[model samples]
Target: MSSYPTPTLATARLVLRPLVATDAEALFAVFSDPAVVRYWSAEPWTSVAFAEQAIARALDSYRAQSEVRFGIVLADTGALVGTVNLHHFFAQNRRCEIGYALASGHWGRGYASEALEAAIGYAFQGLDLNRIEADIDPRNGASAAVLERLGFRKEGYMPERWFVHGEMADTVNYGLLRRYWNERP
Candidate 1:
């Protein structure tokens, strides 16, 4: 896949940038909350070590040009609220998967959508990707709605796709094409 520098993206209320080591504490605070990771494939983080390790991995991935994970922050307060990432790249197909998580307290405020929109824009314009995909637990209606609002269509479903924390979860797949996004209002 093509590698591009992680640019700082801005929206009306949020900023999307690469993760930093100093963000460990704030990252821990967001990921440790069970409510924030209810639909995630992994359990709630129990330690700051996880955040530090994750930051290290992100740095490695950035260097390898394999994935780009942005730490979503409030533009005004400069507080880290969550993360949105474009990963699982398919260079031959010009495609990748989009994923994100936000603190529960920040929900209902459109932060996730704002950050995701910026990421998707970058993927299409900066990386020259043609398609982006999302996989969500079927029960995550809020996430599904966000994808739909961004012009991603429900493409397929897979039963028992993930075994997370002893639960066999179904996945609802969504996809957005460059043409579709370009036509979006």
Candidate 2:
């Protein structure tokens, strides 16, 4: 039996579930796009091996019950779109961090927002978590906007927190409390 069978989260158009080895190709397609990863903490993946390694790590984390990463897919065609993750678990405090990515081809649509909603709902309800946090490059306006739309408030800013690909970037922190999420209109 699986240590943590990642529950499937579905909306009208998307399905979020645990990634399998077979998803490596689609996963590589999403992360290998420069446009999709421009503001990401890591640079674009160079090979399918990166996706394979990531799935390997995700599987290990799942078995250890340390992190939950969900692959976002289109419901109609079951095509991989992106991913949403809840990691850095502080079980004693009932808290974790949220992160997500989407293919550039799916940009301008509400896929990220929809997928995040499902993931956040799972974190708070299914996992019984109290707080979820996120830190993103301030230049990622779209990501900040999505977190805001999901009721995550900007909490702090850290300058030059990351030096990825020889570029220094500032981070804006966001946090959402379960009570606040419960109170959303």
Candidate 3:
């Protein structure tokens, strides 16, 4: 696999940058909320320590060339609203997966869409990735709509791909190709 760089990216109203140690408190506020993490693959974080640990791991993974995650910060308030992640890279195939968790308060406001669109652009144009994929909970209509608007087509559904919160959860897989993305309206 090729080592890719994680550089800062800016959208109209948000900034996609690396998470820092100082962001722990704000990160905890977002990840520890049950509502924010309700549909996420991981359980709601219990403490600020979780955020600290996650940031550290994210940085380490970046150095290890395995995964990369960006902290979603509102440009105006300079608040850490959530994260946009692009990981599970396959350099040979030019494919990767994207995931995110925005603060519940920021949902319905297009922050996730803006950040994701920027990230997708970087994945394709910057890293030269040909394909980007997302595995979301089928129940998440909001995420489904976002993916659709971004030109990702729902290609498959897995009945029990993840065991979350003591239950078998389904996954809706979405994909977008470079050629299609380049021609997106």
Candidate 4:
């Protein structure tokens, strides 16, 4: 059986669910925006084809029992504003990495934090995970703030860990153990 089964998760204003091929256009728009993906580990997606392939890869990740990437849908309009993810599942260690990217237009609206809270709750409760880690570029203060608010503590840092946008950047690692996680259903 797959360790990660995509489930419908709901919050006050958003629904976290599996991405489908039909969501390609909307997802592409979110990913194609440079501002949205500036701090992302990967470069900005440039085509709808990439979004389609990404959805396929997400399913493959679940099939392999390694990860889950859920599209964050607005509860009222059902518009896909972003994605919340738990990846690099380490079953033996009972750990995983959590991440997200929201459409630029949705920034400062509390969407990412709300969606991530629900996703992390799923990791700790639904999946029985022991720890969740987040790696962010040290310069991305906004993301750092979100991680901090979610009760993740800075665990470490690696200098020049990633080469992005033609430059090297340091990475800050934050972590939260199930015992330390504060959010609840």
Candidate 5:
């Protein structure tokens, strides 16, 4: 079994923790909303059952040696505000992909950025990753801004890279190396 500790990462206004089965309700609340999933997966969640299944998959990912999923909780209210993950961990390459989403109600508040910063810190300091990447829809200025604010440089644009809503969407790739993080203010 992997020895990764299930620890909570705290930011100024957010708490990042592993997803528990009991989080299904909160996950459903965020994911079932059309706005929240618009730029994420291909389809919006239709029921709480989908959230349950997703939670199950998250649990499985946690059990694996290469992935970590975290639920973003509001520090003040303790509400499940979003989710973030580090996946495709490459031991040989010392790299990983970072993905995140926040509830519609939580958007525009910097919660996603705060949660992502914590995740990045964990990846670099805790996991000793050398590089981190985020793939975002080309039109998602907010997400792009988050990556940029966190010192990720836009590396490329992949045309028709992801299929969403029955149409192929272009994706922008952003990446930050350990040296980049070290040079940040």
Candidate 6:
């Protein structure tokens, strides 16, 4: 069985941990909000039931060793604020894809960046990955900014790459290699 390092990751203001069934309600609250889902791949979650199913799938992915999904919690209050994940793991290539989202209420607080930084550190140092990438919608400036701030350089832009919210969207690819991380202070 593939095992992951423990679930708890603590940053100054945030806690990243495995998603639990009880978190479904809180996740639903954030995910079902239309404003939060505007830039996300799926439409607003219709109900808690949907979030429950999503949580189940996330748990399964972890158990199967296919992905690592963490619930982003506010350390001060222990509230479920969002999620971040490392997916599409290519162990042979020592690479993976990173993805994240936060509730509308938590935007601009640097929570996403902190959470991402922690995840990247785990992937590169703890997990021994050589590269990490973020595939973002070209129009999503906020996400692009997060990747850029984390030292991921924009490598390419693929036009008309995905259909999101009924429109074809271009994708900007951002990548960070271990060589770059090793050189950072």
Best TM-score goes to which candidate? 1
Instruction: Estimate the TM-score of every prediction.
Output: 0.97, 0.96, 0.96, 0.94, 0.95, 0.94
Assess candidate 2 and give its lDDT.
Answer: 0.91
User: Per-residue alpha-carbon lDDT of model 4 for 1-185, expressed as tens digits?
Assistant: 33788789999999999888789999999999999878776788877899999889987876776687899999999999999889888888989898899999999999989999999889988999999999999989999999988889999999999988988989999999887775523
Candidate order, lDDT descending: 1, 2, 3, 4, 6, 5
Candidate 2's residue-wise lDDT over 70-104, tens digit each?
99999999999899999888878889899899999
Candidate 1 lDDT at 159 equals 97
Off by over 4 Å in 6: 1-6
How far residue 146's Cα lies from its native spot in candidate 5, in Å, is 0.5
Model 2, residue pairs in steric clash:
none
lDDT of 3 at 129: 94
Q: Encode model 6's per-residue lDDT on 50-153: one tens digit a residue.
A: 99998998989877768888899999999999999988888788898988889998899999999998888888887888999888887788888988888899
**Candidate 4 segments exceeding 4 Å error:** 183-185
The digit string of per-residue lDDT tens for model 1 on 1-185 reads 36756788999999999999999999999999988888888999999999999999999988887898999999999999999989988989999999899988899999999999999999999999999999999898999999999999999999999997789999999999999999998
**Which residue pairs in candidate 4 have backbone atoms (N, alpha carbon, C) closer than 3 angstroms, thus clashing?**
none
Q: How many pairs of residues collide in model 4?
A: 0
Question: Residue 73 of model 3: what lDDT?
Answer: 98
lDDT of 1: 0.93
Candidate 5 lDDT by residue in tens digits, 76-149: 99889789988877777888899888999988988988888899988899988899998999888888999999
**Candidate 2 off by > 4 Å:** 1-5
For residues 125-160, could you state the per-residue lDDT of candidate 3 as single tens digits? 999999999988998899999999999999999998
Give the least accurate 10-residue stretch of model 5, judged by summed lDDT.
1-10
- Pick out the ten consecutive residues of candidate 2 with the lowest summed lDDT: 1-10
RMSD of 3: 1.1
Candidate 5 root-mean-square deviation in Å: 1.5
Q: CA lDDT of each candidate?
A: 0.93, 0.91, 0.90, 0.89, 0.86, 0.86
